[model samples]
Target: MNNKPLAERIRPEKLEDVFGQEHILGRGRILNRILKSGRITNMIFYGPPGVGKTTVANIIANMTNKRFYKLNATNASVKDVKNIIDELDTLFSVDGVLLYLDEIQNFNKKQQQSLLEFIETGKITLIASTTENPYHYIYKAILSRSTIFEFKLLNKSNIIDGLKRAIKIVESELKDKNIKIDEEALEYIANVSNGDLRKALNALEIAIFSTNLDERGIIHIDLNTAYDCTQKKILNFDKFGDNYYDILSAFQKSIRGSDPDAAIHYLARLIKAGDLISICRRLLVTASEDIGLAYPNAISIVKACVDTALQVGLPEARIPLAEATLLLSTAPKSNSVIKAIDAALYDIETKDIGDIPAYLKDAHYFGASKLGRGIGYKYPHDYDNNYIKQQYLPDNIKDVKYYIPGKNKLEEKIKSYINRLKGSEL
Candidate 1:
């Protein structure tokens, strides 16, 4: 009401006032334990936007009774980092200075490295906030020195509670007019904001200012008004961050788990984030790793879809991507090929594999038949069904069964054929 945005005006002043991230902020949680210890360390707070990273840092600074120095890493340089350390060194206090760096991922290697000495020496307690994953964005040396706490997106109930608080603050600020919002309107805002409290509050503030007051000075907000106030919801997805990998993991797992609907949902998330290459690459991996041999042609279809997506590049790319996602999700699933290769590699690394059989050795080279290379190797093309009983593996691992076909139709056929050739059940 005093020209400050609702989000800024209602920022939580204490840990109790903060919402969500209960896994980290609830009693007996890591953060709570750290706060209760009366000593704070250099730490990184990472999460999506509008999830109280900065607010939580401020609360920690206040709760620990430390002098807080805030800097936006986007504009701050290595010199600024060094200067903050210099300034903190001069401060004579038992509670140390808390240097809260926002968008800490923007600090390149040099800038982040500049703070290591100070953090290590206890001259400054670094509280870095980033929307990106610290492990990928921050310097490993700094990561090794700091504790990392991950924040999560606020749920619908959390957003609703925050919106209700915002409404109360607005009504109190505008004492001359009564501002009223329906429950459904709040819920709509919560739903559209996609668990972002800042966006939801901003939308609520817009709705409040845009609506007309009645004769009794009551400004009523409905679902329609809320929808109009908040147009298209902006998704918070950092292509280079944890959300990107998280979505990709979920998408692949959904397809592997044979949940086309969930696969589509995660695919839509990736598409919304405008990550075409990741989608294509993940689809290819899923096709080969999750839907291998069971449907040998699935990889070709996925590859075609990927090529189409790469050529078309979004909007239309989503069509082929969707097709590929559904295809992989519905295709006969098998990890036999991947498992077979992994098992072979594991044995190669962990076991003493004997030399290749003389019959299976490379006889095409200048070695000739003098060494008996390829002497006993039978040409399967001359036999019935183009098959023959022979030891294809090394002498030590001749009986190893690495390729275990799955129970899908195609794999069942393969199992039958292999069983017939081997004259035993596979």
Candidate 2:
């Protein structure tokens, strides 16, 4: 009778047993090469939860003879770190130490800097994991010293494979060949996991134990059982469900359509469903895509609101999310930003753009002047009004218009300023 949760009871012990993350774990990959060399460097793993960050770290520790120490940055402090450092002279630590720090983003600047000396001297091999962007949350000095690897969310097939393995393990534990599962039920659990294999395993375990055995002495699982175990009634994970993406779509469309009432209506529906991540992401995108230069400051406001929503979370998060929705709905709309970027991308893919101007090429290198690089460059600030007309585009596409100002107040003023500078209307 194992008391541990199914996720931990059946955790992958080797890289071959680990699912997904093949980009880093696949044959002949950089991580594989490093592991083969038997020298693990300072590294950072960045990804969402349940994507095998901890599992990979465990595998690395198992492969090496080094002393392994695990600490969660959310709870562990400098004192806990000092405890490990103090043990360096002990008998078992002769092979060096591998410290797997989870949620390393939670460690503040001073706490992170404390590890600089140990990692620099190869006394401790640091494998830090973060759910957030490492470049944004980690110290730059630490980033320069470590290689960062991104873990992607598990696709449906990857999750299904894991679920199948879990079922086999459960059958072996229960010593029963009578456990039966519907294919649809299995997929339902996988779909509702939302790229998280741990969630699917937990849901499957609940569905198996909660259901009563029939007169035939066989346990059966169906869609209803999975739905109940997953609690999808409140947090709809089905992308096609009315309670899921439809509401999210309407929420963004309402904002883009400038209907504050409709936008608020959809926002309330999303908040009720407890989909704060979706609401925050869509709000941030709408603020930039729909609002644009019409109200250039809307992006910063929406960003602050999204940050506040994420920090506070749930019922309290609804306040800032609602504010962002209302602001984007009522704010003037513009598709100019998307249009300009898409147009530029299309030309890059389709056209044969010539080389960059010699003046715009990298000129800091030795003998750049010999190749005519930076020869005719004109400094804008050296001219009147801190402006100077120059040929910025490549020779082939110099006349192509990628940016066209939208007829909004801010953009109109911008167009006027540019027109005055060029002595012509754009």
Candidate 3:
């Protein structure tokens, strides 16, 4: 008996009823294969909101004819979850419980970890959904255990199709009221909703309630009214303490996109908000990791700016700070620095992080040269230092080459120097 209207009344109840994600739900899809074969794995549906994640889970439940239960990580707790597991044991004698956990990443590590056995032992077929990227935010062990399916946001055409479905619902619900809505206005609602089908439907519901006259009466629903009705919903980007990520995102995108003006704008925002110190540190890193060698001088200049800011203090230090940002934004960009480290890290992960070659190791200690550790070591000062083919790599990594310098002025010099030093080896 709530005052909510059409969209609420007609939420889809079956898989065939769900829209979008055709690849997953289309004929003979992998997901369909999993379900029809009775081998559906523990899954995590990850993407932006309202692209049929929940509906898919429901379809899974329906296909299996299993007991279905929903828990929101926002409200459910350890005890509550345990209670639900116990309740499933008590109520359902069917194959398994199909547990749909929404916003699963919101649960802390321990809470999430609790679900592992239930998944492993086949106590439940857990389908978790999250808007945030779980790879970054969720615990690793949990992620490794589950199959992940990424869902993308619906595009314009998909949104139009979903809107058409909503229109049918609206027409059905308000049939007795003799009310009508313009297709263009409905399309505007779909556009504003931005691929969130729930958002589009919700906006349609609100617009219906807000309009005093339907198409038969006054035929009114201007772009402003359709827009204002939904856009007024809260999007408060509370610039509280934790806005560091947001600021960093803006800075990274600006520098990567080569918009020096926007980079400066984001810098000003962080600086004004008293997060200048953090901004300065990240920029110091960005100069080397992102703009390194492309503009080798950028790192030293950024370091100088950091020192200047710290030594002289803020109120007046923003001058050098601004200068460093301008140089970094306008300078040539390269990810070679970070890419080198990342590739090295990948090697460490998949292969052994081998030790330095004996030749590369220290020979200064007693009895050291006898072990061939530094027996043939070539001190650059002993000779010309211009072209010395020293064994620098660990035995394991001797033939493994990782770092590829980006095309930049300083790296070109580095390439030439390396070529001269290791002419035969290279």
Global Cα RMSD, each model: 2.7, 13.6, 7.2
lDDT by residue for model 3 (304-408), tens: 888888788777777888888888888888888888788888888898768876777788899988888776667776667645556677677777766776787
Model 3 spans with C-alpha error above 4 angstroms:
1-7, 88-91, 136-145, 177-184, 232-284, 297-406, 409-426
**Deviation of model 1 at 137, angstroms:** 2.1
Scored by lDDT, the top model is 1
Best by TM-score: 1
Question: Model 1: runs farther than 4 Å from truth?
Answer: 89-95, 300-320, 348-358, 361-367, 370-373
Candidate 1: clashing pairs of residues: none
Task: Estimate TM-scores for all models.
Answer: 0.89, 0.63, 0.64
> lDDT of all the models against the reference?
0.88, 0.87, 0.74
Alpha-carbon shift of residue 143 in model 2 (angstroms): 1.4
Give the candidate order by descending TM-score: 1, 3, 2
> Which ten-residue region of model 3 has the weakest summed lDDT?
233-242
Task: Please write out the lDDT profile of model 2 over residues 278-317, one tens digit for every residue.
Answer: 8888998888888898998999999999999999998889
